[model samples]
Target: MEHSDEWTFADCFHAQKELYRAIISAAVSIRWMIEHDFEVPTDADLRQMEAEVNRELCDAWVEIYVLALREWLDGQ
Candidate 1:
């Protein structure tokens, strides 16, 4: 468990370290959900109210990966 002020950044030598891992973790979870058929059921009916939220989640995962990679490379 981590106990630090959310607004604070940790010390950096080569890098702050935690940023990349947290971003990767979230991306991994989203990928797993998609690969495991987490979005099998769909709310496609207008009467039932509908949207492909899983699609959006996957997009968010890609965005996270991009941010993580950019930060890591910049630190190097």
Candidate 2:
């Protein structure tokens, strides 16, 4: 996956460092959600619980992609 800001990393080392952080944060958030039983809020409550859930999911995905991309870059 392509990072939102390519300028953030000048070399593979930087990418790996950044990705490690992303992975840790994602794992924590996902674990919290799972432990709390994140619920899919209804349309009536889209602005509340549902929106938060969506954000969490998006964050998780970004972290995973970043880590995978970092690994790929490392091999290059």
Candidate 3:
């Protein structure tokens, strides 16, 4: 989504949720790295990983936007 300085309450909550999800994801990755030697993946591997991650994040953002829009429309 495009950046904005103004954030409503629900937007803030969604932002926080996204941040928390990212942190938790990072923590798991870090734990895995600590347990084993991390090796760089091939270009194809990177692309696949990126695609999966992007899809998941997009789904999350869609959910957030849908909820926010629903609430906004309800108020009208």
Candidate 4:
């Protein structure tokens, strides 16, 4: 006797769901930045502000790249 299983479909579905979520979240952050361009800090605050900007830019870029990759993967 043999037992049958159906896990591949489930696995692919989960992966697609996560990919969609990541893409949406990345897009949202980019929009948020564009919509709200407030001032940064000065003096000591300037250093901290610069650091924060760099971090946010890096994160946003990573997300954009990931979403692009996912789109490419879906195509292939």
Candidate 5:
């Protein structure tokens, strides 16, 4: 599958369900961390965490997807 900025949720769902699941799991893990690790986290802290999580997850997904694609291609 070709990578494109125009890819939709259905495309990703069909192409890589595991990656989608991992993204959700990571987001939930971060939510749990905030709830347990913070006594009184400020709004700014929450926002920062949210942004960082999103950035990290997106980067991770792209990297993993590319690597998976490379392996698939190599086997072909």
Candidate 6:
């Protein structure tokens, strides 16, 4: 399959969807931690959570891109 750097509308839309999902999931996880933990999260803990969410967002974007590429190839 030929690879193109261009992105389609559907690709952007799906990426946005995945990003929103990741954000929501991160928010829920943070809330859970805040509610269940005996002490407030330390600065290091917050930093770790931030890093994890960033990784999750990056993974989601990559997954969306791969899926879009596969669909484009199938349509070819």
In model 4, the Cα lDDT at residue 11 comes to 52
Candidate 3 shows a clash count of 0
Per-residue C-alpha lDDT of model 2 across residues 1-76, encoded as one tens digit per residue: 7666443334544555556556655665566558668865355544554456555556666565676667666665
lDDT of 3 by residue, 5-76 (tens): 665657755765577468555654565456557766567755655565566566677566766667555654
Best first by TM-score, ranked: 6, 4, 3, 5, 2, 1
Off by over 4 Å in 5: 1-37, 63-76
Best by TM-score: 6
Candidate 2 Cα outliers beyond 4 Å, as residue runs: 1-10, 39-76
Predicted structure 6: lDDT: 0.69
Name the runs in model 4 displaced over 4 angstroms. Answer: 1-7, 38-76
Tally clashes: model 6.
Answer: 0
Per-model C-alpha lDDT, please?
0.47, 0.57, 0.62, 0.54, 0.63, 0.69
Q: What does candidate 2 score on TM?
A: 0.34
Counted clashes in each candidate structure: 0, 0, 0, 0, 0, 0
lDDT order of candidates, top first = 6, 5, 3, 2, 4, 1
Regarding lDDT, does 1 or 5 come out ahead?
Answer: 5
Residue range 1-76, candidate 6, lDDT tens digits: 8987776758665866666677757785777587868467788877777777767666577666766667666655
TM per candidate: 0.33, 0.34, 0.39, 0.40, 0.38, 0.43
lDDT: which is higher, 5 or 6? 6
Off by over 4 Å in 6: 1-28, 31-38, 63-76
Tens-digit per-residue lDDT, 1-76, candidate 1: 8886433222332232345445545665566557767754344332222123344445565555555566555665
Comparing 1 with 2 on lDDT, the higher-scoring candidate is 2
Residue pairs that clash (backbone atoms under 3 angstroms), model 1: none
Which segments of model 3 are wrong by more than 4 Å? 1-6, 40-76
Least accurate stretch of 10 residues (summed lDDT) in model 1? 44-53
Compute the lDDT of residue 21 as modeled in candidate 6.
70
Model 5: lDDT equals 0.63
Global CA lDDT of candidate 2, please? 0.57
